[model samples]
Target chain A: MTNDHHIRTRLRDKIVGIAGCGGLGSNCAVALARVGVGRLVIADFDKVEVSNLNRQYFFADQVGMPKVTALRTNIHRIDKDIMVDSHELILNPDNIPEVFNDCDVIVEAFDSAEMKLMIVETVTEKMPGKPLVCGVGLAGWGENNDIGMKVFDNVYICGDHLREVSPDFPPIAPRVGIVANMEANQVLEILLGKMNDGNNTQ
Target chain B: MEITLNNRKETIPDGDITVADLIRFKNFTFRLLVTKVNGRLVKKEARDQVYIREGDDVTVLHLISGG
Candidate 1:
């Protein structure tokens, strides 16, 4: 096969599942779609609010729309032919496996620490050997270079690894985008079987 | 006793130190954190009971959010 065909074939056979359709999930979906991922399974029960416009991938007009549907619409806008399995429901440990069973990689993009930990723990436990990409400590307007990636067993975590959210430090677009892109890149790396080259951990 | 904390070698008084005790010893005040010992997760409720031994790899990650 030609090099171009080989690249297309690889992207066309992989599926990614995102746990939240907020900033990280929505942006990651767009990146994956642009790269021609075969399918995406996205879940989010919350609706867009005016506050999410700062970092999330939703326009003001999309406020009040369920995040999953809004994200689906947005992803289609990027690549109309990309297949998306959108779920508009609150995800719990009991149902996560069912929703994302076929995914080769799962991205944990929840906003709360509790939810992030829950998804990471549940998915790792329920689906041993499946790789999970998660983000943490990307808050504030600190130096974007602080964001980095680390690999622990089957889990890949991306972010600054410091600077928790506070009244003074808030989640903004630039830093969040950096971490989200890192997560997306990690997914691509895992799918392409390049995870063992020794440069991914940061 | 000596243990590897986040990959750095550190020495503490020889005895059994629960995950909580180690956190206290390290002065980790961050509220949003996840602890793993030897590659297994130590949930919040189990921190006080989970013990760390010599040569055990412990990772304490703080989970905050921007996205």
Candidate 2:
């Protein structure tokens, strides 16, 4: 393997806090671990359900496990040296301050609209300058609508925007994968300060 | 008067309205979350009262999923 000292030196010691450890969060966390993110704080108040086995990295044995714990197990399986701090509670007004305190960036990965808004509002109110890259509109069907990318300052929104217009696509794996990768790419860009807000890839 | 849904422009009567009012007028089901406006995601509590001005662009999204 080529010694990619640049990525290692840059990603080393950078702290990323993920708010939801479901499809997008779990995938992103694993990808970041592979690349060499110094520390990852994974928080999810949800437990693994039988349905999460499809796209998420959790195993069949971890079907009833807390998502954070399952995600930690998955990440360790990939890279045992990667440091992961698992929080077994939902992100809310009370504990958000400490959850985001040392994070260099925040990844919003919840599936519920309410939770997504909560984390965004909490971060905006508490840490305005901290950048957040989030995923949205990835539900439903069709490859044409499942991909989109946009960036604004520290905020990047990904996924499909068809919930209102097209009432067909239900949130699924293909949709989630395309959007999740977009989010992970944004995280890498932001970490390296290579993101230009004007770029919109849809 | 005109309004924009997501981003595409559309015709509408000229009036001051909140996002919730417009969404309700369209008979939209209250399910997907509205995270950012013009670029910022908003809290659920503020969604009802968030005022929409002329020529403003809004992006709404959800954060939860099983996968």
Candidate 3:
């Protein structure tokens, strides 16, 4: 195999923190680990449930396990050398900074609207200038083409930019994976200093 | 009378209009929405208090849960 020094040396040195180890967090963590991100800080207060198997990376056997711990095990299965910092604690505005202090880029992967807003607000307030990759509007089986990226200062929002979850429209695996992978790609792009202004890869 | 809504020039009533009013006027029914005026985030509670003037850029983003 040809050696890619840049990806092995530079990319592996970066640290990424993922908030909320649900579908987005779990999938994104695996993507990053496959690409060889040096360290990962994953925080989540919840445990794995059967419903999460639809999109989340955890398996059926992993149910009832704490999400952070389960995620760490999954990521290590991909890259045992990758450093994993798993925190099984709820992240609020008051403690976000402390939990994600060592991370270079923080990924907002919460499922609730209020929690998403709180993470964005708290991160922007306390960690000014830190890059944050966030996911929004990845509901339903809408056209995958609608999935896009939007950049605001240091915050990168990835999703279809429409279609909230409803009785008629639910969060399926295809759309969720598209958004999750977009978020993971953004983290890698930001780490490699390759991200530019405007939308990327609709 | 006119302001840029999501980068498209639109006309609103010739008077003060808050972000909440704009959201209603545009018929954005999404429960989870994020609004920013001129690149600054406007909290949900403050959307009613924050007014939009002419020539300002307004972006409204909808938040959803799948991943």
Worst 10 residues of 3 chain A by lDDT: A193-202
Query: Model 3 misses residue A71 by how many Å?
Result: 0.8
Q: A1-202 in candidate 3: lDDT tens per residue?
A: 2334546576687899999999889999999999889999999999999989989999999999999989999998888999999989999988899889989999999988778878887876678778999998888785878878988767899987677667798777888888888999999888775635422222
**Which lDDT tens digits does candidate 3 get at residues B1-67?**
8888776899988788899999999999877777888877788899999999989888886665555
**Candidates ranked, most accurate by lDDT first:** 3, 1, 2
Which candidate, 1 or 2, would have the higher TM-score against the true structure? 1
DockQ score of the complex predicted as candidate 1: 0.58
Residue A16, model 3, lDDT: 95
Best by TM-score: 1
- Candidate 2, superposed: residue stretches over 4 Å from native: A1-3, A144-146, A164-168, A195-202, B1-67
lDDT of 2 by residue, A171-200 (tens): 567667666777777788778765456322
Q: Is the docking of candidate 3 incorrect, acceptable, medium or high quality?
A: acceptable
Q: Which predicted model would earn the best DockQ?
A: 1
User: What is the C-alpha DockQ of each candidate?
Assistant: 0.58, 0.27, 0.47
Q: Kindly indicate the candidate among 1 and 2 with the higher lDDT.
A: 1
Structural similarity to truth (TM-score) of each candidate: 0.88, 0.74, 0.84
Worst 10 residues of 1 chain B by lDDT: B58-67
lDDT of 1 by residue, A1-202 (tens): 6654665577897999999988888888888888889899999999999999999989899999999989999988887888999999989999999999999999998888888878877865788778999988778776867878888778889987777667788888888888888899999988876746743332
Calculate model 3's interface RMSD in Å: 2.5
